[model samples]
Target: MRIEIWADVVCGWAYIGKRRLEAALADPAFDGVPVEVVWRPFRIDPTSPARSTPLEEALADPAVDNALRVCAPGLSPGENRTRVSDIAAAEGIGPRWGAAWRASSHDAHRLLFLAHEHGGAELQNAVAERVMRAHFVDGADIGDRRTLAAVAAEAGFADGAALLETGAGEDEVRELLLIGKARGVATSPTIVVGDRALAGAQPAEVIREFIARGGHRRELPDEVERLRHAEALLDRRDPLGSLVLLRPLLDAYGDDRNVLMLAARAYFASAQLGRARATLERLVGDTPDDSYARHLLGRTLQRQGLAEEAAPHLSMAAAMSPEYD
Candidate 1:
């Protein structure tokens, strides 16, 4: 079995997903199967400047708030550091999200590429894990060559400093990133087993089930692909484009949970509050335990001056995500 994971070192959910996959592989269900794991590069912020940003300022960005809410619903930007730290602790990694600096992971990806080239999968995995821990737990500026070199050295690279000085593996890293983008990898922690992809931080049981089923490729239909493109457009702040793509899917598969969720998000982003509310209300009514839907519905209602109605849903969403503030 071969698994390729597209993720960024700075992604908290990717770190959690890595741990979950590790646990799944450790299960006795696949005791004798030989599995090859490869880590591919995916930059969360490809255009982010190399300069380090203060954690507070980074977390305060609306984009960061939205991303955090996906993983830890109802969490305010100010509370995300604590929420991620707690998750890291539970996953057995040291907690230091509060102290971490925010920067690009481009240079770190280059180092990982070099690690894989020189020492194969074991060394590459070690370097990648240490780099994530360095960023999420040790507060290291992973974009810095010096910081990357130190991490690479600790992971058993003999000439880590020289490699960084010469900018080794930069081209390979860039190529890998291009490959990931071409493969519809818009999010971190996209684990690819054959043609099957498991997005987000899936639980161990889900991963175990996937492994048990032979990890075969399940190609997505054209409509699902369109929906995914719509989602990407929404993430890139092109709500109108997303809506244009989603309208057809909405007519064809209005009852699809993913389509409805994307439609709601598109409507919300485009300031179509009524449509957002209607779509989300239907979604929430069908899936009451969906914290994301509940939060979105609450926000939509609040925007329309229905605070009294929104309060219960918001409260429920927050209660469901106990780590949030």
Candidate 2:
């Protein structure tokens, strides 16, 4: 069976749905199955500047409303609830909605391309998960080349610099948008199995059946086992339950920035200006060009009574936020 998934990494459904598809493919039923997989291009928010914008700002933009609606609030990236997709992640065909909504698929998808170059399918999956976590969970910007490259490298990407170059390099991404339009793909998260199109966030069984039935069937569910675990944790509502669940997710995924960011924010919120500065400093070392990271770092400096030192960072952040300003 040949599985051709026409998806954008920015598409939360695609990020979530890809997990479900993987779970089904790992089934014993597919142990000996022959599968040919390909990732075609489709950009729902093709003109969204392809840059990493803060979630708060992106939500307010009128330009990509259609894209936002399709991705859904089910993919909402706020401080509180991410979504049912998150709680259902381990169940079978659900995603993790508890992350921030820094929705930009270009960087993440580009990592997959790099993964293909370095590690083939396995690496691709690893890179994909890293990107999802960065944008969704870590609340970091996947659209930022430096950030994406860091995550990719942590996921075992051999060429971090090379990957970043590709991420910042997206003439091909624009081409994919054209391909999507030509093919009549109206929305993102569209999975192409041969010529078959599977749209929206679907159940794992649907994915399994699709892959099992051979070319052009419903798609299979995500990993039932993982979703089951994630669901169990969701029901507990333990303050640290999700945190505990997040351990491995972070481990397999990239935990560096998210952990650092979470800690930095906590310190900042509590007026622990020194700690926040320290944390962000480390992140800057990892992703020197991340404007938002720099923005937060500058804020920390201002709070710490270091206005003079914060000037450059503030200047850069403002510049990045200003094309329309």
Candidate 3:
């Protein structure tokens, strides 16, 4: 069996969900099930600025406070580090949420994507586990490249600094975000099993029930895999390589959403702004509710010096995916 979990590093419930899933897999019933788990990237604050926000200020926001309370019941509307700490302690996963939990998780996700690409599932899981612990326990700013590099190094990456400096895995991270959004993953800690999904921190028993139901393993088709490789090429800062793969796929699968999105990305990365605009416009027209498409379309227009036309799309994209800032 395989499980794909879409979650953000800063999401408290995602940490809890990870623990619950671990417990479920540890159950005697699943002792020999031989499961594969993959973590997919989802940004909790994609629009967060590069600078860090004070944790207290973030906690003071009603929405943020509410989310914290949902993850750790009885958490007050103000700074409730103690309450969050207690919750983390109960799960045996941390030092606790504290002053260090403020920052965008975009960069952290990029590192994770790189880990998965370079070291496979075990390494990716290790990196993700450490990142979540850093954010929710030790209160480390996962957004900072240095912090992420340290975590990656500990997770067995020998050249974390170089990877960060090169901006490796960024395009893959963005592509994963779009894939998650298109798959209807609107919340952190959403575990998809075959066609069914379990959202939030579900109990171990619930997870076991899902296991018994037996979901089909999620696998990308060959064409989609080609598109994914193209995205990775783009992430490596190779626009020409990405376009080589994408252009052929576009010719063959012109209307396929994933193909179009990858082609648009390739064009944008290569500075073929007009082609990008045309592709994105068609994508947005086909899937109006796709937040990623709208966001990219807005960016494409903005790059073409059409900010006036891009503003509404950008605003709507942000509104639709508020977690992205």
Question: Residue 78: error of model 2 in Å?
Answer: 8.0
For residue 65, model 1's alpha carbon misses the true position, in angstroms, by: 5.2
**Residue-by-residue lDDT tens digits, candidate 3, 174-285:** 7677656545677888999887888777888898788778877458787776677677777777777677767668788888888888788888888999999999899889
Ranking by lDDT: 1, 3, 2
Better of 2 and 3 by TM-score: 3
- Local accuracy of candidate 2 as per-residue lDDT tens digits, 1-325: 7776677766667666777777768878888778756665666565556656666677677655545554454454341234545444554432334444545566556556556656766677677677767766566767777777688778887685585674443544444444454444665566666556777657777888776766544444433333333334334332233334334544564445665565555556657688779878888878887777788889899888899999888888778876312
Per-residue lDDT of 1-325 in model 1, one digit per residue for the tens? 8888899988888888899999999999889998878889998777567888877687788886676578656776557666767876887877445446778888888887888888888888999888988888788888778888789889998776688789777766865665565467878889888867888878889988876776665678978766776787777777876787777788988899999999999899899999999999999999899998999899899999999999999999999986423
Go through the candidates in order and give each one's C-alpha lDDT: 0.82, 0.62, 0.79
Residue-pair clashes per candidate: 0, 27, 3
Clashing residue pairs in candidate 3 are 47-324, 96-137, 100-139
Model 3 misplaced stretches (Cα beyond 4 Å): 59-76, 79-85, 217-220, 224-248, 251-325
As a whole number from 0 to 100, the lDDT of residue 295 in candidate 1 is 92
Q: For model 3, give the 10-residue run with minimal summed lDDT.
A: 75-84
Q: What C-alpha lDDT does candidate 2 achieve relative to the native structure?
A: 0.62
Pick the TM-score winner.
Answer: 3
lDDT of 2 at 291: 75
Residue 91 of model 3 has an lDDT of 76
